[model samples]
Target: MNGHEQGNSRAAPSRLRIVVDTDMGVDDAAAVAWLLSQRERPVELAGVAAVWGNTGVDAAAVNVVALLRALGREQVPVVMGEAAPSSGPMSPIGSLVHGADGMWGRAAGTIATCPKDLVAFYRAVAAADTTLLALGPLTNLTRVAALAPDVLRRFARIVVLGGAWRHGSITPVSETNFWHDPEAADRVLAERLPIVLVTRDAHRAFALTHDDLAALATAGSPAARYLAAPMRAYAQVTGRFGEPLNFPDVVAAVLAVEPAAATVRRSALVRVVTGTHGLVRGQSVMGFADNERLAMIEGGAALARLVEQALAEPTLHLGRALAAILAREPDNAEVVLAVDAARVRRSFLCALTREART
Candidate 1:
């Protein structure tokens, strides 16, 4: 059964309260857009914290608010997260990777109010049993882990888009997020709190095809247009290397609600090393076998459907839609599969067409 299920009906989880930390990259924008589109779902857009990864922290913060407003989620708080790793100086990733000003280099003034401290913001809401989705570096999360270990346990789960249980994106073994802040990644993973590390290996399964973008664009919504361009850019870079963009993070966000629709694997003791591909690069080691498995939920179609449904409304992708559908069949895989396939096909066709022309 999923976390939403097997709970007291009277006081069951108050929807999947989530605080998403993003760097405002193209994919990051899409993920945020996906969440914003879910206004009718059970997941609550508690807050959005921007961290420096694909772009500057300031840029990321602006992008978050712009995306929220464009998607009609201006009410959702857009907080500025960590500027960068709280360690030595580091170089920016690349403009092509995350665009000029992170999410299209928009203005920061767009955001209603910038958050004071991302770590503290996360700590406060986490106590309400929210799931923290770390889409960027784990700096804020690491800070929280160090300051209040209870906050880590307060949330039912923490879904991180970084780390590579098997490999990395910048290197053969080290992912960029972990490499940027290995100390933080290591600290967060060291904790045994119910966590799901959507590693590169698992993320590869949710690659977005050109067809997907095309379909989204054809949808003729602001989000669809917003999603189409970056998606196209992502395809360009990946096509150069003949690789697909690892998108497990987006899937993880959706699965945070309906986890039973996935195949989970457990890692008891997980650790991450620092640096680029070298002797002491970012490496993960398992200390012991843990009963808790990282739920490997792979329903591209279902996720695509969720994305579409979330984006359909444009303003707010609340978790009410997912909750409503989920309330009926809380433990049925076939039902989830049906939703997944239908959604995937729609997005795949559109994205695929857009990529071909561009």
Candidate 2:
């Protein structure tokens, strides 16, 4: 079932309206592209909010605009956010992973403007049923909860692409996103939002290999060229001893739109503890399950299908079945049309490689 069909079958009004909160890394960019292209949830993409993680919000905002423009989604308001928290050591940059200025080296000017307040911004956009697809650190979100608890109460759910039930990408215990902002994580989990935890334990189920990417690059599509730079970057940074880096986050976001299309296990409460001994700091713990287990299982073909559909469809406009995005985010129109056709061509090649393997 699609996200909405799985939620409730009785007289549904329309598709799920979602806002992506991301750090604008290559993986996050992939996730955003994938989510926006989905027909299942038919994400509205109210706005792209930046947080401090792979890159700071300022840089992230610029990168978001660039990627959106590349995808032909420039009108999507790329909102700048807190460069750093009110009081804390700034989070370290994953420049080696995302490049110096976030978009694999593309530079663009970001106007010095920001939302008057994030809590208010969220309140204005989110209804009682909006979903927040969070693909970065929880700093902005956590801050929203603290300043205006009621504003946060309106969100229907928060799907976090950070943390790990056991295995971690950054350190033995902590996932890089959570480790960067543990305080925010604590606040997020504490809030009563129905959290769909897409942890490392779950994300690892989907892997995009080098050979997989290389095949696409050889295909000579516009999307293939787009995927080349970041795919190479990802392989270089997160890899261990020549092994390719395992990227499950972007694929996880794709899976979220169609959970039925994926194999996912459920957990009652997923929490992180900041202070601890060696190899245990920032580790994610599940209360009920001894270890995280799959509640749902989607085959590799299902994921491949999701990617295939995204690549096939035009990212320039809202799906005919769902007009909410086009209606609400009218500003995104030019960016949608301005998408580099070549980049889209490359994306198709990447999907073709995935399709062939599947």
Candidate with maximal TM-score: 1
- Model 2 misplaced stretches (Cα beyond 4 Å): 1-14, 39-41, 85-87, 107-116, 218-224, 275-278, 289-357
Tell me the deviation in Å of residue 111 in model 1: 5.7
Tens-place lDDT digits, model 1, residues 13-33:
456688787777777776666
Error of 1 at 105 (Å): 3.8
Candidate 2 TM-score, true structure as reference: 0.72
lDDT of 2 by residue, 124-191 (tens): 77776677788887888888887888776687766777677567767876777777776677667767
Model 1 worst lDDT run, 10 consecutive residues: 330-339
TM-score of each: 0.72, 0.72
Number of the top lDDT candidate:
1
Q: Rate the local accuracy (lDDT) of all candidates.
A: 0.62, 0.61
Span of 10 residues, lowest total lDDT, candidate 2: 329-338
Candidates in order: C-alpha RMSD to true structure = 16.1, 16.9
